[model samples]
Target: MEQTEDEGYHKLDHQLCFPLYAASRLVTKCYQPVLDELGLTYPQYLVLMVLWESDAVNLSRLSERLKLQSNTLTPLLKRMEELGLLTRQRSKQDERSIIIALTEKGKSLKSEVPRLQQQLMDIGISKEEAIQLKGLLTKMINYISG
Candidate 1:
Protein backbone atom coordinates (compact mmCIF):
# COMPACT_ATOMS: atom_id res chain seq x y z
CA MET A 1 0.00 0.00 0.00
CA GLU A 2 1.26 3.49 -0.90
CA GLN A 3 0.88 6.38 1.56
CA THR A 4 -0.06 9.77 0.04
CA GLU A 5 0.58 13.30 1.36
CA ASP A 6 -2.93 13.42 2.74
CA GLU A 7 -2.38 10.36 4.98
CA GLY A 8 -3.27 11.27 8.56
CA TYR A 9 -0.07 9.80 9.98
CA HIS A 10 2.10 12.00 7.74
CA LYS A 11 0.76 15.39 8.81
CA LEU A 12 2.13 17.25 11.85
CA ASP A 13 -1.23 18.92 12.45
CA HIS A 14 -2.94 15.56 12.77
CA GLN A 15 -0.79 14.47 15.71
CA LEU A 16 -2.58 14.96 19.05
CA CYS A 17 0.59 15.62 21.06
CA PHE A 18 2.19 18.42 19.04
CA PRO A 19 -0.37 21.09 19.81
CA LEU A 20 -0.21 20.30 23.53
CA TYR A 21 3.58 20.37 23.48
CA ALA A 22 3.70 23.66 21.54
CA ALA A 23 1.03 25.30 23.64
CA SER A 24 2.81 24.30 26.84
CA ARG A 25 6.04 25.90 25.63
CA LEU A 26 4.19 29.01 24.42
CA VAL A 27 2.43 29.43 27.77
CA THR A 28 5.74 29.05 29.59
CA LYS A 29 7.27 31.71 27.33
CA CYS A 30 4.39 34.05 28.20
CA TYR A 31 5.24 33.52 31.86
CA GLN A 32 8.95 34.16 31.41
CA PRO A 33 8.97 37.93 31.97
CA VAL A 34 6.68 37.72 34.94
CA LEU A 35 8.77 34.98 36.54
CA ASP A 36 11.98 36.85 35.69
CA GLU A 37 10.93 39.70 37.96
CA LEU A 38 10.99 37.21 40.84
CA GLY A 39 14.22 35.61 39.61
CA LEU A 40 12.55 32.26 39.14
CA THR A 41 12.40 29.62 36.41
CA TYR A 42 9.03 28.13 35.52
CA PRO A 43 9.62 24.89 37.42
CA GLN A 44 10.77 26.84 40.46
CA TYR A 45 7.64 28.94 40.23
CA LEU A 46 5.56 25.77 40.18
CA VAL A 47 7.37 24.48 43.26
CA LEU A 48 6.72 27.77 45.07
CA MET A 49 3.07 27.55 44.11
CA VAL A 50 2.73 24.10 45.63
CA LEU A 51 4.64 25.07 48.77
CA TRP A 52 2.65 28.27 49.09
CA GLU A 53 -0.51 26.24 49.24
CA SER A 54 0.89 23.88 51.85
CA ASP A 55 3.41 25.42 54.22
CA ALA A 56 5.58 22.35 54.58
CA VAL A 57 5.72 19.01 52.84
CA ASN A 58 8.20 16.19 52.52
CA LEU A 59 10.19 15.83 49.31
CA SER A 60 8.29 12.71 48.31
CA ARG A 61 4.94 14.44 48.76
CA LEU A 62 6.12 17.42 46.76
CA SER A 63 7.45 15.15 44.06
CA GLU A 64 4.08 13.41 43.86
CA ARG A 65 2.13 16.67 43.79
CA LEU A 66 4.33 18.23 41.10
CA LYS A 67 4.53 15.06 39.00
CA LEU A 68 8.31 15.30 39.13
CA GLN A 69 10.97 12.92 40.29
CA SER A 70 12.96 13.70 43.47
CA ASN A 71 16.14 13.95 41.42
CA THR A 72 14.53 16.59 39.19
CA LEU A 73 13.06 18.56 42.10
CA THR A 74 16.23 18.40 44.19
CA PRO A 75 18.28 20.77 42.05
CA LEU A 76 15.51 23.34 41.82
CA LEU A 77 14.93 23.13 45.56
CA LYS A 78 18.64 23.58 46.17
CA ARG A 79 18.72 26.74 44.03
CA MET A 80 15.69 28.15 45.83
CA GLU A 81 17.38 27.41 49.12
CA GLU A 82 20.53 29.18 47.98
CA LEU A 83 18.42 32.16 47.01
CA GLY A 84 16.82 32.26 50.51
CA LEU A 85 13.43 31.40 49.09
CA LEU A 86 13.00 28.12 50.97
CA THR A 87 14.67 25.67 53.30
CA ARG A 88 15.03 21.93 53.20
CA GLN A 89 15.72 19.89 56.29
CA ARG A 90 15.28 16.40 57.59
CA SER A 91 11.77 15.69 58.76
CA LYS A 92 11.43 15.18 62.50
CA GLN A 93 8.93 12.37 62.21
CA ASP A 94 10.84 10.59 59.50
CA GLU A 95 14.54 11.21 59.74
CA ARG A 96 15.12 9.76 56.29
CA SER A 97 12.73 12.25 54.69
CA ILE A 98 13.33 15.90 53.91
CA ILE A 99 10.73 18.60 54.43
CA ILE A 100 10.60 21.69 52.24
CA ALA A 101 9.29 24.98 53.64
CA LEU A 102 9.19 28.46 52.20
CA THR A 103 11.05 31.40 53.60
CA GLU A 104 9.41 34.78 54.23
CA LYS A 105 10.60 35.91 50.82
CA GLY A 106 8.96 32.94 49.14
CA LYS A 107 5.74 33.56 51.01
CA SER A 108 5.80 37.16 49.83
CA LEU A 109 5.78 36.02 46.21
CA LYS A 110 2.14 35.06 46.66
CA SER A 111 1.18 38.73 46.35
CA GLU A 112 2.55 38.88 42.80
CA VAL A 113 0.66 35.84 41.54
CA PRO A 114 -2.70 37.58 41.23
CA ARG A 115 -1.35 40.06 38.72
CA LEU A 116 0.35 37.28 36.79
CA GLN A 117 -2.88 35.32 36.66
CA GLN A 118 -4.76 38.41 35.48
CA GLN A 119 -2.25 38.95 32.70
CA LEU A 120 -2.60 35.31 31.64
CA MET A 121 -6.40 35.62 31.63
CA ASP A 122 -6.21 38.62 29.31
CA ILE A 123 -4.33 36.65 26.67
CA GLY A 124 -6.80 37.03 23.76
CA ILE A 125 -9.41 34.57 24.90
CA SER A 126 -12.76 35.06 26.58
CA LYS A 127 -12.89 34.09 30.27
CA GLU A 128 -15.44 31.39 29.42
CA GLU A 129 -13.23 29.93 26.75
CA ALA A 130 -10.29 29.91 29.12
CA ILE A 131 -12.30 28.05 31.73
CA GLN A 132 -13.49 25.54 29.15
CA LEU A 133 -9.96 25.05 27.90
CA LYS A 134 -8.68 24.46 31.40
CA GLY A 135 -11.39 21.89 31.99
CA LEU A 136 -10.62 20.08 28.78
CA LEU A 137 -6.89 20.08 29.44
CA THR A 138 -7.44 18.81 32.95
CA LYS A 139 -9.61 16.01 31.63
CA MET A 140 -6.97 15.05 29.12
CA ILE A 141 -4.32 15.04 31.86
CA ASN A 142 -6.43 12.82 34.05
CA TYR A 143 -7.11 10.41 31.22
CA ILE A 144 -3.48 10.16 30.29
CA SER A 145 -2.30 9.88 33.88
CA GLY A 146 -4.71 7.06 34.55
Candidate 2:
Protein backbone atom coordinates (compact mmCIF):
# COMPACT_ATOMS: atom_id res chain seq x y z
CA MET A 1 0.00 0.00 0.00
CA GLU A 2 1.20 3.51 -0.84
CA GLN A 3 1.76 5.59 2.29
CA THR A 4 -0.50 8.61 2.67
CA GLU A 5 0.80 12.14 3.32
CA ASP A 6 0.12 12.06 7.08
CA GLU A 7 1.47 8.53 7.38
CA GLY A 8 4.66 9.31 5.46
CA TYR A 9 5.51 12.49 7.42
CA HIS A 10 4.13 15.55 9.32
CA LYS A 11 3.79 13.54 12.49
CA LEU A 12 4.69 15.03 15.86
CA ASP A 13 7.76 12.80 16.06
CA HIS A 14 8.97 14.15 12.74
CA GLN A 15 8.85 17.77 13.90
CA LEU A 16 11.92 19.17 15.69
CA CYS A 17 9.77 21.85 17.25
CA PHE A 18 7.59 19.47 19.20
CA PRO A 19 10.22 18.13 21.58
CA LEU A 20 11.67 21.59 22.05
CA TYR A 21 8.22 22.85 23.02
CA ALA A 22 7.63 19.93 25.37
CA ALA A 23 11.05 20.25 26.97
CA SER A 24 10.56 23.96 27.48
CA ARG A 25 7.21 23.33 29.18
CA LEU A 26 8.56 20.55 31.39
CA VAL A 27 11.49 22.68 32.48
CA THR A 28 9.08 25.46 33.35
CA LYS A 29 6.93 22.97 35.27
CA CYS A 30 9.97 22.04 37.34
CA TYR A 31 10.17 25.64 38.45
CA GLN A 32 6.54 25.76 39.64
CA PRO A 33 6.87 24.54 43.20
CA VAL A 34 9.91 26.63 43.94
CA LEU A 35 8.33 29.65 42.34
CA ASP A 36 5.20 29.21 44.42
CA GLU A 37 7.20 29.59 47.62
CA LEU A 38 8.32 32.99 46.47
CA GLY A 39 4.84 34.05 45.29
CA LEU A 40 6.02 34.38 41.71
CA THR A 41 4.97 33.06 38.33
CA TYR A 42 7.64 31.99 35.87
CA PRO A 43 7.59 35.26 33.98
CA GLN A 44 7.61 37.31 37.15
CA TYR A 45 10.59 35.39 38.41
CA LEU A 46 12.35 36.17 35.14
CA VAL A 47 11.61 39.89 35.49
CA LEU A 48 13.01 39.88 39.01
CA MET A 49 16.13 38.03 37.95
CA VAL A 50 16.81 40.58 35.25
CA LEU A 51 16.20 43.48 37.61
CA TRP A 52 18.47 41.88 40.17
CA GLU A 53 21.23 42.18 37.63
CA SER A 54 20.41 45.78 36.72
CA ASP A 55 18.04 47.44 39.14
CA ALA A 56 17.01 50.61 37.35
CA VAL A 57 16.43 50.33 33.63
CA ASN A 58 14.00 51.80 31.14
CA LEU A 59 11.00 49.80 29.97
CA SER A 60 12.30 49.50 26.44
CA ARG A 61 15.61 48.21 27.77
CA LEU A 62 13.74 45.71 29.94
CA SER A 63 11.59 44.59 27.03
CA GLU A 64 14.77 43.97 25.06
CA ARG A 65 16.40 42.02 27.87
CA LEU A 66 13.35 39.83 28.42
CA LYS A 67 12.70 39.39 24.71
CA LEU A 68 9.08 40.29 25.39
CA GLN A 69 6.90 42.86 23.70
CA SER A 70 5.99 46.03 25.56
CA ASN A 71 2.27 45.28 25.35
CA THR A 72 2.78 41.89 26.96
CA LEU A 73 5.13 43.31 29.59
CA THR A 74 2.90 46.22 30.59
CA PRO A 75 0.31 44.23 32.51
CA LEU A 76 3.01 42.08 34.05
CA LEU A 77 4.85 45.16 35.20
CA LYS A 78 1.65 46.69 36.54
CA ARG A 79 0.96 43.59 38.61
CA MET A 80 4.52 43.56 39.86
CA GLU A 81 4.13 47.19 40.76
CA GLU A 82 0.92 46.46 42.68
CA LEU A 83 2.71 43.70 44.54
CA GLY A 84 5.28 46.25 45.68
CA LEU A 85 8.00 44.09 44.15
CA LEU A 86 8.95 46.87 41.79
CA THR A 87 8.11 50.43 40.84
CA ARG A 88 7.68 52.19 37.51
CA GLN A 89 8.16 55.87 36.89
CA ARG A 90 8.52 58.26 34.00
CA SER A 91 12.16 58.94 33.23
CA LYS A 92 13.40 62.50 33.79
CA GLN A 93 15.36 62.43 30.56
CA ASP A 94 12.45 61.06 28.58
CA GLU A 95 8.92 61.14 29.89
CA ARG A 96 8.03 58.68 27.17
CA SER A 97 10.16 56.05 28.88
CA ILE A 98 9.15 54.17 32.01
CA ILE A 99 11.89 53.31 34.45
CA ILE A 100 11.67 50.12 36.50
CA ALA A 101 13.35 49.75 39.84
CA LEU A 102 13.14 46.98 42.41
CA THR A 103 11.45 47.95 45.64
CA GLU A 104 12.91 47.03 49.03
CA LYS A 105 10.61 44.02 49.04
CA GLY A 106 11.92 42.97 45.67
CA LYS A 107 15.53 43.42 46.73
CA SER A 108 14.87 41.27 49.78
CA LEU A 109 13.99 38.36 47.53
CA LYS A 110 17.53 38.25 46.20
CA SER A 111 18.67 36.13 49.10
CA GLU A 112 16.30 33.34 48.09
CA VAL A 113 17.65 33.03 44.56
CA PRO A 114 20.15 30.33 45.50
CA ARG A 115 17.21 28.25 46.69
CA LEU A 116 15.59 28.74 43.31
CA GLN A 117 18.81 27.74 41.52
CA GLN A 118 19.03 24.61 43.65
CA GLN A 119 16.18 23.31 41.52
CA LEU A 120 18.65 23.00 38.65
CA MET A 121 21.11 20.93 40.72
CA ASP A 122 18.32 18.59 41.75
CA ILE A 123 17.46 17.90 38.12
CA GLY A 124 19.16 14.77 36.72
CA ILE A 125 21.51 16.51 34.29
CA SER A 126 25.12 16.89 35.32
CA LYS A 127 26.81 20.28 35.42
CA GLU A 128 28.77 19.63 32.23
CA GLU A 129 25.71 18.53 30.29
CA ALA A 130 23.75 21.55 31.46
CA ILE A 131 26.52 23.91 30.37
CA GLN A 132 26.79 22.24 26.96
CA LEU A 133 23.03 22.28 26.48
CA LYS A 134 22.82 25.94 27.44
CA GLY A 135 25.62 26.80 25.00
CA LEU A 136 23.90 25.02 22.14
CA LEU A 137 20.54 26.58 22.91
CA THR A 138 22.14 30.01 23.13
CA LYS A 139 23.73 29.46 19.75
CA MET A 140 20.37 28.47 18.32
CA ILE A 141 18.81 31.59 19.84
CA ASN A 142 21.52 33.82 18.42
CA TYR A 143 21.24 32.27 15.00
CA ILE A 144 17.46 32.63 14.96
CA SER A 145 17.62 36.18 16.29
CA GLY A 146 20.44 37.15 13.96
Candidate 3:
Protein backbone atom coordinates (compact mmCIF):
# COMPACT_ATOMS: atom_id res chain seq x y z
CA MET A 1 0.00 0.00 0.00
CA GLU A 2 1.22 3.53 -0.77
CA GLN A 3 1.02 6.28 1.81
CA THR A 4 -0.96 9.29 0.73
CA GLU A 5 -0.46 12.89 1.90
CA ASP A 6 -3.29 14.88 3.51
CA GLU A 7 -3.87 18.32 1.97
CA GLY A 8 -5.42 19.76 5.12
CA TYR A 9 -2.12 20.78 6.66
CA HIS A 10 0.41 23.16 5.10
CA LYS A 11 3.90 24.31 6.06
CA LEU A 12 3.73 26.72 9.01
CA ASP A 13 5.97 29.21 7.24
CA HIS A 14 3.67 29.28 4.24
CA GLN A 15 0.55 29.90 6.30
CA LEU A 16 -0.01 33.66 6.65
CA CYS A 17 -2.45 33.17 9.54
CA PHE A 18 0.10 31.53 11.81
CA PRO A 19 2.48 34.49 11.66
CA LEU A 20 -0.28 36.90 12.65
CA TYR A 21 -1.42 34.63 15.44
CA ALA A 22 2.11 34.06 16.66
CA ALA A 23 2.98 37.75 16.46
CA SER A 24 -0.12 38.65 18.45
CA ARG A 25 0.75 36.16 21.16
CA LEU A 26 4.40 37.20 21.17
CA VAL A 27 3.50 40.88 21.50
CA THR A 28 1.16 40.08 24.38
CA LYS A 29 3.96 38.18 26.10
CA CYS A 30 6.23 41.18 25.63
CA TYR A 31 3.68 43.36 27.38
CA GLN A 32 3.03 40.89 30.19
CA PRO A 33 5.88 41.87 32.48
CA VAL A 34 5.25 45.58 32.16
CA LEU A 35 1.51 45.14 32.68
CA ASP A 36 2.07 42.84 35.66
CA GLU A 37 4.04 45.59 37.39
CA LEU A 38 0.95 47.77 37.23
CA GLY A 39 -1.35 44.90 38.31
CA LEU A 40 -3.01 44.72 34.92
CA THR A 41 -3.71 41.94 32.45
CA TYR A 42 -3.43 42.47 28.71
CA PRO A 43 -7.18 42.85 28.28
CA GLN A 44 -7.29 45.29 31.17
CA TYR A 45 -4.67 47.38 29.42
CA LEU A 46 -6.95 47.50 26.38
CA VAL A 47 -9.84 48.72 28.53
CA LEU A 48 -7.56 51.30 30.09
CA MET A 49 -6.57 52.49 26.64
CA VAL A 50 -10.24 53.02 25.81
CA LEU A 51 -10.90 54.81 29.09
CA TRP A 52 -7.77 56.89 28.71
CA GLU A 53 -9.23 58.29 25.53
CA SER A 54 -12.68 58.85 27.02
CA ASP A 55 -12.80 59.07 30.76
CA ALA A 56 -16.53 59.06 31.42
CA VAL A 57 -17.95 56.69 28.90
CA ASN A 58 -20.87 54.41 29.61
CA LEU A 59 -20.33 50.68 29.86
CA SER A 60 -21.97 49.99 26.53
CA ARG A 61 -19.72 52.47 24.78
CA LEU A 62 -16.64 51.06 26.48
CA SER A 63 -17.69 47.56 25.53
CA GLU A 64 -18.24 48.64 21.96
CA ARG A 65 -14.91 50.43 21.78
CA LEU A 66 -13.01 47.47 23.17
CA LYS A 67 -14.96 44.97 21.09
CA LEU A 68 -15.77 43.11 24.28
CA GLN A 69 -19.12 41.79 25.32
CA SER A 70 -20.63 42.75 28.67
CA ASN A 71 -19.88 39.37 30.20
CA THR A 72 -16.13 39.81 29.66
CA LEU A 73 -16.05 43.46 30.68
CA THR A 74 -17.89 42.76 33.90
CA PRO A 75 -15.15 40.70 35.48
CA LEU A 76 -12.40 42.95 34.17
CA LEU A 77 -14.21 45.94 35.56
CA LYS A 78 -14.61 44.19 38.91
CA ARG A 79 -10.88 43.56 39.09
CA MET A 80 -10.11 47.14 38.10
CA GLU A 81 -12.47 48.34 40.80
CA GLU A 82 -10.77 46.22 43.43
CA LEU A 83 -7.46 47.70 42.38
CA GLY A 84 -8.93 51.18 42.90
CA LEU A 85 -8.27 51.94 39.26
CA LEU A 86 -11.78 52.67 38.12
CA THR A 87 -15.37 52.72 39.26
CA ARG A 88 -18.47 51.32 37.67
CA GLN A 89 -21.71 52.84 38.75
CA ARG A 90 -25.30 52.80 37.67
CA SER A 91 -26.33 55.90 35.79
CA LYS A 92 -28.65 58.10 37.81
CA GLN A 93 -31.00 58.61 34.91
CA ASP A 94 -31.17 55.03 33.70
CA GLU A 95 -31.05 52.01 35.96
CA ARG A 96 -30.30 49.81 32.98
CA SER A 97 -27.16 51.67 32.06
CA ILE A 98 -23.78 51.70 33.79
CA ILE A 99 -20.99 54.21 33.52
CA ILE A 100 -17.27 53.62 33.85
CA ALA A 101 -15.12 56.38 35.24
CA LEU A 102 -11.49 56.28 36.12
CA THR A 103 -10.37 56.87 39.66
CA GLU A 104 -7.46 59.25 40.22
CA LYS A 105 -5.21 56.21 40.31
CA GLY A 106 -6.36 55.14 36.88
CA LYS A 107 -6.03 58.63 35.50
CA SER A 108 -2.49 58.81 36.85
CA LEU A 109 -1.59 55.66 34.90
CA LYS A 110 -1.97 57.50 31.61
CA SER A 111 1.30 59.40 32.07
CA GLU A 112 3.24 56.18 32.62
CA VAL A 113 1.69 54.47 29.60
CA PRO A 114 3.48 56.56 27.00
CA ARG A 115 6.83 55.59 28.50
CA LEU A 116 5.89 51.90 28.32
CA GLN A 117 4.73 52.42 24.76
CA GLN A 118 8.12 53.90 23.99
CA GLN A 119 9.85 50.98 25.65
CA LEU A 120 7.95 48.55 23.44
CA MET A 121 8.81 50.58 20.38
CA ASP A 122 12.52 50.51 21.30
CA ILE A 123 12.51 46.71 21.24
CA GLY A 124 13.75 45.93 17.71
CA ILE A 125 11.20 48.13 15.96
CA SER A 126 12.20 51.34 14.24
CA LYS A 127 10.08 54.48 14.81
CA GLU A 128 9.32 54.93 11.12
CA GLU A 129 8.48 51.28 10.66
CA ALA A 130 6.36 51.30 13.79
CA ILE A 131 4.27 54.15 12.41
CA GLN A 132 3.91 52.35 9.10
CA LEU A 133 3.06 49.11 10.86
CA LYS A 134 0.43 50.84 12.95
CA GLY A 135 -1.14 52.31 9.84
CA LEU A 136 -1.22 48.96 8.14
CA LEU A 137 -2.67 47.23 11.18
CA THR A 138 -5.25 49.96 11.64
CA LYS A 139 -6.29 49.65 8.00
CA MET A 140 -6.44 45.89 8.25
CA ILE A 141 -8.47 45.98 11.44
CA ASN A 142 -10.90 48.50 10.04
CA TYR A 143 -11.30 46.58 6.84
CA ILE A 144 -12.02 43.32 8.63
CA SER A 145 -13.98 44.83 11.49
CA GLY A 146 -16.23 46.85 9.23
Pairs in clash, predicted candidate 3: none
Q: Weakest 10 consecutive residues, lDDT, candidate 3? A: 1-10
Whole-model lDDT per candidate? 0.88, 0.88, 0.84
lDDT of 3 by residue, 55-78 (tens): 888999988787779998999899
Q: What is the C-alpha local distance difference test score of candidate 2?
A: 0.88
lDDT string for model 2 (5-85, tens) is 868556777676788899889888888898998889999999999999988889998898888999999999999999999
Candidate 1 lDDT (Cα, 0 to 1): 0.88
- For residue 36, model 1's alpha carbon misses the true position, in angstroms, by 1.1
The per-candidate count of clashes, in order, stands at: 0, 0, 0
For 1-146, candidate 1 gives per-residue lDDT tens digits of 35577686677887777988998898888888889988999999999999999878899999988889999999999999999999999988889999999999999999999867765765777889988999998897788777
Off by over 4 Å in 1: 1-7
TM-score of 2: 0.89
